[model samples]
Target: MAGPGQRGVGEPPRLLKIVMAGESCVGKTSIVRSYTDPHGAPTSSSYLTTIGIDFKVKPVMFDDIRVKLQIWDTAGQERFHTLSTSYFRGAQGFVLVYDITNLDSFQGITSWMKDIHEKAGDEVDIILLGNKCDKESERVVPKQKGEKLAWEHGIPFFETSAKDNVNIEDAFSVLTKEILEKKSCVLYDFDVVALNESKKRTCCAF
Candidate 1:
């Protein structure tokens, strides 16, 4: 029996695993915390360093689909690199964060993307986010360059201010939509059938 707003049996809810990665102090944790708890007061400062990885689950309704996003926030410093790769194994989506006010952080995006591709592979969906967009005076990375990079990588780019709540929801929503649309091709039983057929063809050719 279906609950009031639930889908019927055998139909799995659309679930996505997303990871946030960037250089140290690039505002990855702030973005995640803001999105998860929009009404909560802003923190004075980031208190704890993300040791290895942290997880949070948030359910959102996109059109008719119910999406449960499993968000993984990883440590961004070089020391945490080894610990971080393990969390990227099964990621379906990624949010590559960079601080607009920090040139070094923005430049380091290429390295983050490389790590993501090396671990999660090229097929995983990714969105490039420019954090701290509200700090116009300190903005170092031009928005156009971010867009260009995102285009080159075949991913969407968003300029967000987690502190001011600017484009915060929009960025996340776009990611969810992209994941549901692109990743949907392999999420269910039909993909299993396709895989079996592919395997059969390979075996028969041997």
Candidate 2:
């Protein structure tokens, strides 16, 4: 039976795993909380430390299709490197965060990038996020520096404030769209998702 909305209202959404990685206190957890907050409540200013790892399940709708995002929040502590790095497998995308107010956190992104590439597959998409943009007075890492790093690695970049919910949804939406627009690729809970010329024509004809 075909439902009214989209193509398959009853069909299970395609699952996509995403991970947030960065140095400690870079606001990884806060970002997830803001995105998945059901009540639209304000994000707490208090620092929330993830001990080992945490997961949040969010189903985001793209027009008519719903995609479930299993977002893994990794502990930034060096002690958890062995545990956190293990969870990077099978993830389709990564949101690498860096605190704009902390230069050291910015510098630590190199190692995180290496770990993500080594632990996760090389083909996975990644977006660089500079968090805490609301704290302009304490800005240590310039936006140009962040832009340069992203350019060097060939990834999209966004300056976000989780507390204020600035650019959080935009970044995730862009990454999701990129992941979905790939042709003849396999993702979780689905088989052979293709957005090629044939698929596009079929969709347009509908």
Candidate 3:
């Protein structure tokens, strides 16, 4: 029996795992917090760094289907690389973050990209995010630079300010859509193969 507004028996929400990775102080944690808890709290000046990896699960509805996103917030420090990198194996998508106010953080993206390719493989979906976009006076990495990087890498890009709640939902939504599309394509291919096999058996019967 199906409860009101709930999926019936055997119809469970799809599970998606996503990870956030970038250099230290790039606001990856803030993005996760903002998306998961839109009205939780204001951004704090003295925020503690994540030690190893923290995660949160959020359920969202898309096209009448419920999807549960398991988001892992990874530590950006080099000491935690071994631990964080291990979480990338089963990720369906990733949010690669960079601080707009810090040129070094933006430059460090090369190493992060390398890690992604090495751990998550090249086929995984990724979205580039320029955090702290509200700090215009402190901006060092221009929007054009982020856009160019995304274009070169063939990924979508967004300028987001987690403190101000800018484009946080959009970024996650884009990645979720990509994951669902990829999953749908895989299922479609399997169905086509099964149909072809069925046709072969039917012809033999005749």
Candidate 4:
């Protein structure tokens, strides 16, 4: 593991590979754009569509630790299911998104979570994000229900508004921090053979 201030001149300190999975038009892209370009003006619409999978890298500082987030935005179309599974390889964390105004999107969370756990393992870190929180009048899924679902799955949940920039940063920040903490703990466990070999080598030199 690379510590803070130890990164090479041009290289990043840590790489966090995260994947955003949800139904189409659930504001996954908007959330990514808002975090990556917070100051940019909102556009009326954008026709950009993720073919198999699209990636973006953004550097963020969490409690003095610099982290480079490798975000993968996946296609939600049913026809692309075969292609999307391939992108799940080596994903350390996940952001399961759902539109607040769409009930179907919320219902699909179960299947999506199962797919992620199957591909990345049950130990993989995950965060649930309810997008379009600003649209309260049109919300079909209640906040308490979403929170309950997240609790049942043992994952953190947040209501985020990409349009208003509400809790968007907090959601990602917490998930990233959790990922780093888990990674650090795993790195502390040393192999018995490696430790014994080093001790023997030191004794011979002396």
- What C-alpha lDDT do the candidate models reach, one value each? 0.82, 0.86, 0.86, 0.81
Top TM-score model? 2
For candidate 2, the TM-score is 0.84
Model 4 scores worst on lDDT over the 10 consecutive residues at 184-193
Cα deviation of 47 in candidate 3 (Å)? 2.4
Worst 10 residues of 1 by lDDT: 1-10
In angstroms, how far off is 181's CA in candidate 2?
A: 1.9
- Could you tally the backbone clashes for each prediction? 0, 0, 0, 0
TM-score of 4: 0.81
How far residue 3's Cα lies from its native spot in candidate 2, in Å, is 20
Q: TM-scores, in order shown? A: 0.82, 0.84, 0.84, 0.81
- Candidate 1 has an lDDT of 0.82
lDDT of 2 by residue, 1-206 (tens): 12323566566677788999999889999999988992574664775789999999998787566788889999998999889989998888999999999999999999999999999868888999999999999999999999999999999999999988899999999888767665234354535354366688898999
Model 2: worst 10 consecutive residues (lDDT sum): 183-192
Judge candidate 1 at residue 172 and give its lDDT. Answer: 90
Writing each residue's lDDT as its tens digit, candidate 3 over 5-48 gives 34432346677889999988899888898899989945934567
How displaced is residue 71 in candidate 2, in Å? 0.4
